[model samples]
Target: MHVSEHIIDIRYAETDQMGVVYHANYVIWLELGRTKLIEDLGLSYIQMEQDGIVSPVLDLQVTYRKAMRYGEKAIVKTWIEAVNPLRVVYGYEILNEKGELCITASTTNILVKKDTFRPVSFKKLYPDWYEIYVREQKNENIN
Candidate 1:
C-alpha cells in the first residue's frame, strides 16, 4: 500500500476551550492528507479541475481516539483504502508527537463534472489513476 505522510504543527488557534485540538479542525487535516496522497501519486487536483473534473467528498467518517494539545506535531498518514471507477475511499490516521493515534477516519469521494455535478468514472477519464489506485488497494487488502 502507498502511504503519504504530512506533518502539521498544532496551532493554538486549532485548540478548544479544553486545551485540546478542536474536532472540526481534524476534518481540514484530513483534506490536507488526502491532497498530499494525491500529489504523491503524481496526480494534481488542480489539473483535474482545469480539465473540468472535480472530485467531491460523498461522505466522511472520523473517530477521535485521543486528545492533542498545542506545541505538539500531528503526523497524518493517508492511503487508499479502496477504489472503484466512480468513487475512492481514502483512509487517515493522525498521530501525536508520541506516535499515539489521535484520529482515525475515511472519506469517500467521487469524480464529477464541475459544471453539472454529474458523476464521472476515473477508469474512463483517467485510467492511469484508476490503475494506480487498484494496485494500492490490492496491497492494502493483502496485508
Candidate 2:
C-alpha cells in the first residue's frame, strides 16, 4: 500500500536530560517520514511550494508506545491512510532498533493555494499523486 520507510539515527541533541528521546521529537520524525513518502512517489514539497501549492497539517495524533534512547536508530514507516479531494491522512509507525514500536501517529493535511490560502482539491491539483493514493487505499482494504 505505497508504504515508505525512512531511517533516522537518533542524536544526542534529540534526547532529554534522562537520555530518552523527547516526545516532541517524534513529531519531527513524522514530518521526515511524510517527506520521504512524498519523495518516493516522485513529488517534492519544495516543488509544490514553488508551484504555489501548499499542504498544511490540519490534525495530528501521536501515540507513544515506548521510550527510545539516544544513539538508537529509528525506522519510520509511513503510508497514506486515506485521501480525498480536500485532505490527505498520512499514517506513521516509529520503531526502535530492537524492532519495538516506539510510536504510532497520523497527520491530516489540507491542500491550499499558497498565496490565497484557499482550500484546493488535491485531485485537481495533482491527478497522478491523487491516483496513487487512491490505489493505495484500495490495496490496503484488500489486504
Candidate 3:
C-alpha cells in the first residue's frame, strides 16, 4: 500500500509529567505523517486549499500500544487506507526506532469549500488530485 515514512525525534516538550509521550502528541504526529504522505504523492495540502478546497478531518481513531520515552526517534508510517469520491481514510503506524509499534491511528477527511464549508466531491473539485489518488490506490491494490 503506498506507505510513506517520516522520522520524528521525540522532544522533551511532547512528554507529560511522567515523561512519556503524551496521548495527544500522537495526534500531532499523525498530522505530520499525513502531510509527509501527501508530499510523497507530489501533492500539497496548501495547494489544495489554494484551489478553493479544504480537507477537514471528519473523524479520528487512535490506539496506543506502548509508551514512548523522551529522546527516542519515532517513525510514522502513513498510507491511504481508503479513498472514495467524498471521503478519504488515512492510516498510520507510529513505531519506535527499533520498529516496535507505539501507536496506530486513522482519520477520515472530506473536501469542502473553504468559505461555505459545504462538502464537495473530490471528482468535481479536484479532478487531477482525485485521479492521482485513484491511480495510486489501483497500482497498490489498496482498494
Candidate 4:
C-alpha cells in the first residue's frame, strides 16, 4: 500500500488562547496530507474535478491523543486505507516533534458527478484511477 508523510510545523497562529493547536487545524493538515499523497502517485485532485468529477468527504473522524504546541513540528502520515467502487478511506497519523502520537484520524470520500452531485462508481467512469487505487491501497481493517 502507498503511504505519504507530510511535515507541518505548528505556527503561532495555529494555536489558540489555550496554547494548543486548534481543532480545525487538524482537518487542514489532513487535507494537505491527502493532497500530497495524490500528487505523489502522479495524480491530481484538481484534474479530476476539472474532468466533471468531484470527490467529497462523506465522513471524518479524529481522535486527539496529545496536545501539540506552537513552534513544534508535526508529521502527518497519510495512507490509502481502503478503495471501493464508490468510496475511498484514508487513514492519518499526526505525530509531534518528540515522536509522540498527537492524533489518529481518517476520512472517507466518494466520487460524484459534478453536475448531478450523485455518486458515481469510480471503477465504471474512471478505471485508470480505480486501477491505481486497487493496486496501491489495501482494504481497511475495521477491527
Error of 4 at 87 (Å): 0.2
- Give lDDT tens digits, candidate 3, residues 1-143: 57999999999999999999989999999999989989999988998888788889999999999999999999999988878789888889999999998998989889999999999998787788777777655233323
Q: Which stretches of candidate 2 lie over 4 Å from their true place?
A: 138-143
What TM-score fits each model?
A: 0.94, 0.93, 0.92, 0.93
The numbered model that scores best in TM-score is 1
Question: Order of candidates by TM-score, top first?
Answer: 1, 4, 2, 3
Please report, in order, the local distance difference test score of every candidate based on alpha carbons. 0.91, 0.89, 0.88, 0.90
Q: Is candidate 2 or 3 superior in TM-score? A: 2
lDDT of 2 by residue, 3-98 (tens): 899999999999999989999999999999999999998877898899999999999999999999988999999998888878888989999988
Candidate 4 lDDT, tens digit per residue, 74-106?
999998888888888889999997789999999
Model 2: per-residue Cα lDDT at residue 102:
86
Ten residues in a row with the worst lDDT in model 2?
134-143
Q: Candidate 3: where are CA atoms >4 Å away? A: 138-143
Q: Which structure is stronger by lDDT: 2 or 3?
A: 2
Q: Which of 1 and 2 is ahead in TM-score?
A: 1
Question: Residue 114 in model 1: shift from native, Å?
Answer: 0.7
Highest lDDT scorer: 1
